[model samples]
Target: MNKSTINLPENTIFEVLVTTTNNQKPHTKPFGMKIQDKQVVLTLFPNKTLNNIKNNKEFLIQFTLNPLIYTKASLNKLTSKDYQNNNILKEATVILRLKVNKIIEQKNNDKYGENIITTIFSTVTDIKQENIQVPAINRATTKIIELLVDYTRYNYMNSNQKTSYINKIIESENIIRKTGNKNHNKSLNLIKKELNIED
Candidate 1:
């Protein structure tokens, strides 16, 4: 796979939906990853996707900016039909099939507690393009992506932090109005309802 073919910048983490399988059932989740050379670096905790990859040894990476995909994945609502042939997400534009190359164990400790973090280095084994779609580098999508990351921590944050994140979400919603598409609106609303953000 040629890394330069993709529009991603040299060192930026982008929010993307990835697919893995547990017992051959396809699962999708949003992740922040960076493409460096021929490998994609992903830092993961002991989640379903990571655990699945540990046993399965590979996963599919979807390259698209549709927030609805993230919404479905975040809500755990992906059905069997969302996948193609039990391996690839049907909505994907450019896809990368990666095989695990390296796994590093990191000992993490904080005010909450200690935990182990896994850093995965996966080499691209196959690159497929169902369609040629540009990777969006706009503020609307960027802010929404940032909000998605923040919402993942909502249940663990204090009330003040939660308020700050909600404000960002509102601001991002406005930006999406000007710069994003209908799918963005639909996905943002789904997430807002899931987060229980009061109008």
Candidate 2:
């Protein structure tokens, strides 16, 4: 997919299935996440997952690529799928089980809105690696980056600001390369080739 097309589905919410200590079951919530350094950074809105992490400091991250789930999540109408009895793989590519180490809450107010951004830092405890050959790229992340790029056209930004955003995308792609993600590698190479930056 091209940059615009690939980034089209971003900013829309996606299901983040997590296993928390408070519940003996796996809970699924819609979350907006960013891919940074091979780690999925989740920003919680002080909800169940946030509370659970605050209490026990550990959780699992399962990526659900279902379009229906994404649509529901975007509309803030997602219902938790009960995985208490039978653990079934509905729409997860790779499930990353993690233990929280730190939490950072930042107060910020922008022209668009005002809110507290909660950042959760966690370590991967176990990874249920999927055998699917396709590379797992967070579509939301790429779209968000593209949106930021588009937003820049209206706002006055210095050269550094423009470079910084592009660099973030490149860095994310680099992380995929370091992780040996085959699909990501192919996509990254394609992007490089398009930009004529391939060495």
Candidate 3:
């Protein structure tokens, strides 16, 4: 999808189902896809998903609003029924079939602890939307994604960066308080506890 077609919040971590074929078999995993000038960008660390994409240049990104599905995918416990046609997720609100246009490999010494990383730019070949009504506000989803980002960076951050990330989490908590529902509160509380943050 292009910029005019898909509009997500600034710095929003878009959690989606990505299907890749490995050894003539399909594997579904969750990833954060960003939009950049008619291309979907994926900054991925070395893993099974990266290997699959390296072998097969085609994959599908499924946009879903089901938080449970996101959680399951993150935990690597996704069910077979979560996927349909072995390429798209049944719970997806929208689907985009993409082909890799560019793959840039880099090594990071600090941010990623000297790990090999791949940045993928894929073109949208097709789109399948299920008449999904766009929500005016997606604060809870944004907050959850932001909190997770902060949690992952907690150890790598320097003093200043650590403070900034903590401040961001506090801001997310305030937004959750103002706009989040029961599910949001539950997720926030669990994340806070997981990150060793006090109520």
Candidate 4:
């Protein structure tokens, strides 16, 4: 697998949904994932999900931009029934069902030094496209714009970089609008007004 496949887009944050079996129950949690060498790496605290992976050695990974799902999943507020017949999972643009092959534990030294032991491997088993289609409408586009704005502020980007980033954002919004998604058009208009761009 090419490592570049998992690389996160510049100024774009992805919501990673991980499905795991915990105590015979399926649980899903969203993480901010970064792609490296075709593998999705997530910094998970030693929690139930992490423990489930250590025990089961398998999981499902999905990528999505749905803001409502993203917010609910991240806060662990989603009910299992919500995913029962949802099109979101079925319509996921990218899905990876993987089996964990290894695990590497990290340790901290007494001298305040931390050892990074990565290379936990997982084999991808199934990948397919979903048939259900959802356009990048207003809510989605607005959420993306808000996310990019937050990322820029959090990363402390330079003024020139911010301008360039905003420009790219406008282009993305336009693409979504052209694809027959008017939701993003509002965001595009808002961004243009803010940037003082005519038409």
| Best candidate according to TM-score | 1
Cα lDDT tens digits for candidate 4, 57-137? 878777654544443444454576555432235424566777776676776342223444333467666664454456444
Residues 1-199, model 2: lDDT tens digits: 0111112143444445554545554445445565444445677655676787788776766655443433333323334462323333345556666767668899866543466769876666666644354655665435432433333332344567656645655666645556533434554454444335535
Tens-place lDDT per residue, model 1, 81-176, is 877774677788878888899989899875335768899898777777775667647666676677777766666677788888888888678788
TM-score (all chains, Cα) for each model: 0.86, 0.48, 0.68, 0.52
Which portions of model 4 show Cα errors greater than 4 Å?
A: 1-13, 85-91, 108-119, 131-199
Q: Model 1: what TM-score?
A: 0.86
Full candidate order by TM-score, most accurate first: 1, 3, 4, 2
lDDT of 3 by residue, 22-102 (tens): 776667666787887757889887778889988889987887765545545554556677666745677778877888999
Report, for every candidate in turn, its global Cα lDDT versus the true structure: 0.78, 0.51, 0.71, 0.55
lDDT of model 1, residue 187: 76
Model 2 weakest 10-residue run by lDDT: 1-10
Worst 10 residues of 1 by lDDT: 1-10
What local lDDT does model 2 show for residue 18? 54
Segments of candidate 1 deviating more than 4 angstroms: 1-11, 110-113
Better of 2 and 3 by lDDT: 3
In candidate 1, how many clashes are counted? 0
